[model samples]
Target: MSRHIDLAVIGAGPAGARAALEAAHRGLSVTLLDEQPKPGGQVWRAKSAAILDAPPTPETEAGNRLRQSVQDSRVTHLGEARVWQIERAEDGWKLHVLRDGRSSPLRARALVIATGAREFVQPVPGWSTPGVLGLAGATALFKQDLALPGQRTIVSGTGPLVFFVAAEIRRLGGAVAAVITPNSRGDWLRVLPGMLQRPDLLARGVSWVADLMLAGVPIHWRHAVSAVDGGSAVEAVSFRKLGADWTPTGEARRMSADSLCLGNGLIPTVEAAQLAGVELEHCPELGGWVPRHGEDGTTGVPGLFLCGDGAGIRGAAAAEIHGRLAGLSAAQHLGADTRAERARLHPGYVRAARFGMAMTALSTPRAGLAQLTTEDTIVCRCESLTRAAIAAEIAGGANSTNAVKSGLRAGMGACGGKFCQTAVARMIAKAEGRAESDVPPPTARPPLRPVPVAALAGDFDYFDLPIPRPAPL
Candidate 1:
């Protein structure tokens, strides 16, 4: 049996939750689905019960309010529900969901994809080592479990997340050995005016830096990790000064640490949207390829909408506006009168977007990052392929991302290209001297995530199975 709804929101982050709330307010039967047990996405993910009584930050406070509002609203939220596939149907969209070991079908008149963004970790030698994790993943540890990544940690990466994660380590009572990044003070200064446009956020960022300085943490600018060293776990990290393009240039320095929190930045998670048949374009400022849509979130697809980080790398505040506009646009698509509300939110969306874009551009990975890898560094962890192997494949006629994937099985791993796609594409682009966009992403296939065979098989019996006859021999 299939459950039907007026609107189906595919995530429960700030954007998706708000989207469901807005549509439900308009008398629409909206259903919001998220992989987490609670709404808030990553930025606002509810803290663990162990730390529930900890002093709340602005993010936690805002998250609590939003969670309460949804709890009291008319929206129906299905938590821990994984949507494995979405397909166009005669009447609307069909979603195959796996929840609690059961498979179910959900059909909705309209769909909103707020799947959000993923951290982009550039590959360095020994990046696949056990103790190496992304900055965002480290934050998740602090937020959800109140646990630290290591006793002494080396935080190295680009973007605002680098600062936030290092500050979080100190706040959580963990020791931060040092902070390293490719952006020098002068580089950040160039973007200060635009960042200042959001004075409140600027203040928050300053506070993080203040905390690190007060703790006497050394901040190394214009540097990046050259390699990680260990036999089984991270024993030490090697770093070096970087050129303007982020290529290593100076003598390497070694820092002993039990763990390394590293990440380049974030990119929009567009697999779901791509599978939904929305058009995509390469917009580096938006964090690589993003869906093509209007201001109101209407895509070329008739009833599909995209918002939040999934649409692009606009931060959470802008994501909320994006969600609201999408909700109103979706309501209107389903015959609700929402023009007034839509018009009201447009200006704010534009403002937030400008600030967010500036931040994204500042944090965008430099081309020199591509030079960080050695011939033997693992580029695709799943298949254990090296940079040399991938580059050789490129020279051997794999000009496109898909072609490389087909030849070497780089992205055919369990992660479904989540980790390796962008890095691989960069390798292809650099080798072929083509624009990054020229190497289009590999084609999106169905069953958007890996599914257990039993879940899909249901309770079918051998006698009832639709067995096929053998082909003519």
Candidate 2:
């Protein structure tokens, strides 16, 4: 019996459905949460309403107006729920959540966290085959199971999601076979004079490179995909030539493809903002260790905020202007907006926080991509470990990510590591000069709802109550 709120949010994505539709249109009551039963998280993901009544695709019409602003009435949504931790209580933040198999407790005053951003995948060498995948898990299996893990895909990566997964695999007709991009068209012509000072983001990056060059595909650029042949599923890949500190070079071509779609970009899912302690800040141009926020997404935890791409990898129109400046700084921190309506919403939130700091300094990543791993690759695919056992636990001294998860437990399996804990905490903070927020992150317990220990021992409530009858005896 917990469930209370003023604004809980968590994530329904598209920055918690536009910060729960601008804090329930400024009246605030919200609740939102989501493990996704729908409400576009993985970049506008809903589907099934016969694919949401098919038709619209200005990216599913802003995720169908953020799922009709979470069906209004001061929002509640909850979808599949999940949450997991967030604590602070005495009268404000509890959270916990999880769903269906129960385990509740909510209560809020303002928490937002529009928890979003995943997909970085760096292990390589036939990346756990079975049709590879993860340009956002093949665009969330072509947006919610219309499914198309094959039929000759390739779509390697760098950013702007490999040209939006090769324009959603050419709008589902499939057969991409190229789009490689290890980011060097001379680093996109040196970020095109800072992307031509945003002529509408350089005309939507020149209309997504003119719809992947009129869907004839084949873009390659300094290429990448180093090795991914195939035995059981993905058919071929290999490529090379990246050099100038992005690595990969000399002779390797291959390319056949039956699904590869890699990724090397997104990061900030900051596990519920580092389980509510907030304050992180590596900012390798905003993708690793994010949440230090401000300019109205207010972090350093004071009624907790953080918006879009978990407050980093800024995309989706700067996550809808950082979800309208975290719903007008949480409606001016609950006095219900009016410092002249947040000074007339401060110049469109400082022009979407300076166009999300120039697209996070022109899509950062690419620092020799941690020497694209080798030493029999596989860095913690759920503790299978190797990359020479995380460089022999950073050459033993285990320097932070809780001392390399106590020397190579490497984020102790079962994805509590959340896909190899930020590339094993940025390769142990670049081999221990130390400071990816001095490492820490990796402990978010609770069945924050996975349940099914045989459905919690067949719904046992200490063998189904009724013991009070002994008092009557």
Candidate 3:
């Protein structure tokens, strides 16, 4: 008998974990599907025994709470499962899921998507160096295995995340070459007022800054990484200070570093959303193309809702509250009484989300970052397509990002464009002399996360499947 879930929450991140707990608390049988082997999302991904042998931080503690709730609650937590497709069923929805080289169907009355975000790595020369890792990858490596990408690394990017990662790397006993940020002092001052809106967040940033300072790590302000240098792995890096327009203002500074952590900001992972036939709009401030949803996480499609970074890049605080909102709203729609929950928490979620938007606006990358991409710089590292190749496609009458993808195969790689789509769109926008929004993101299709063809074509054993209970007891 196929297991039927009342509400299914995708992802195991802060949003998904909280959403599962909230729905379960409201007397709903929820099945939380996560791709990770463990419960914590990327931000709070569990540490190995060696790493966890040390004490935990508040974030870890919070993650433990959510993990415990999901573990202790009746929520059916399915790890290492990839939800490939969602289709309309007679009663509600049928999700095509692939796991352990087999496919199965999961029926659900309602679905909550909290798949979270992917890093928008700013492409630079030699970025494909062996030692280079995305900001999120760096964090995951540290959290999962206490693995530092390099001995001496340059943690450089456009936002506050770089600072946080740099501090964490140091705490993990990794050496830092420098922390490079493209934002000038003036730009930070502009957001200083908005940062104060959430004193807690502001204090966190202040503390990261202090830790760097105390550790004698140099922070290069108003600078952007120009290139990574190495024959195989990262050996050194070059960066230049930028002006208001993001143009290089001075000579490039070169330094030695074994590894480089790169990211401009986070992009919402919307493949699952797109597969659900959810409408998406390009909103740069919220991290590229995002699924259309309301304050209560209601998508245009009934019985489907979205929350967390998958909905937008509002950080962890906003993600938690939004997850709660989406959960309670979904529960209320399912005939559960959550008015008190929504009434009490909705306002705070909106308030915190506003501040997050403000921060995203302040850190929203400017057009000047594209200037670093020379003809030889590899834009689509997955396919080895250089900036010139994509530009040539543009010159050959490729009008949209999809057209470029078709003609140039920039996104036709194992990564499936997660790393190249934004960069490709920006480059196309520049070449066409149009706004980036003019080029829509490449359409996310079925088999969203790459799966082996055999997995999709194969079936699992029915005999081993557990018999369905009458209903949630």
What's the TM-score of each model vs. the native? Answer: 0.96, 0.34, 0.94
lDDT of each: 0.89, 0.73, 0.84
Cα lDDT over the full model 1: 0.89
lDDT by residue (1-473, candidate 2, tens digit) is 27677878888877777777777887878778888887878888877665656566666787877787677456778788777767888766888776786666788887888878777777777687788877888878777766777888888878567887777777778788788877766676655554454577668666877988886787888667777877788788887877777777778889788878788777777767767777666767667677677756877677888888877875666676677677778767876753565467657655654555555553466656666677787878877887777877777777667677766677666666777877787787777677666775665455433544544354567766666545553
Clashing pairs in 3: none
Candidate order, TM-score descending? 1, 3, 2
Per residue, candidate 3 scores C-alpha lDDT tens digits across 414-453 of 8889888888888878887898778888887776777887
Q: Can you give the lDDT of residue 221 in candidate 1?
A: 93
Residue 98 displacement (Å), model 2: 6.2
Segments in model 1 whose C-alpha atoms lie over 4 Å from true places: 461-473
lDDT of 3 at 133: 91
Give the per-residue Cα lDDT of candidate 1 at 69. 90
Ten contiguous residues minimizing lDDT sum, candidate 2: 447-456
Clashing pairs in model 2, backbone N/Cα/C closer than 3 A? 40-45
Name the TM-score of candidate 1.
Answer: 0.96
What would you estimate as the lDDT of candidate 3? 0.84
Decide which is better by lDDT, 2 or 3.
3
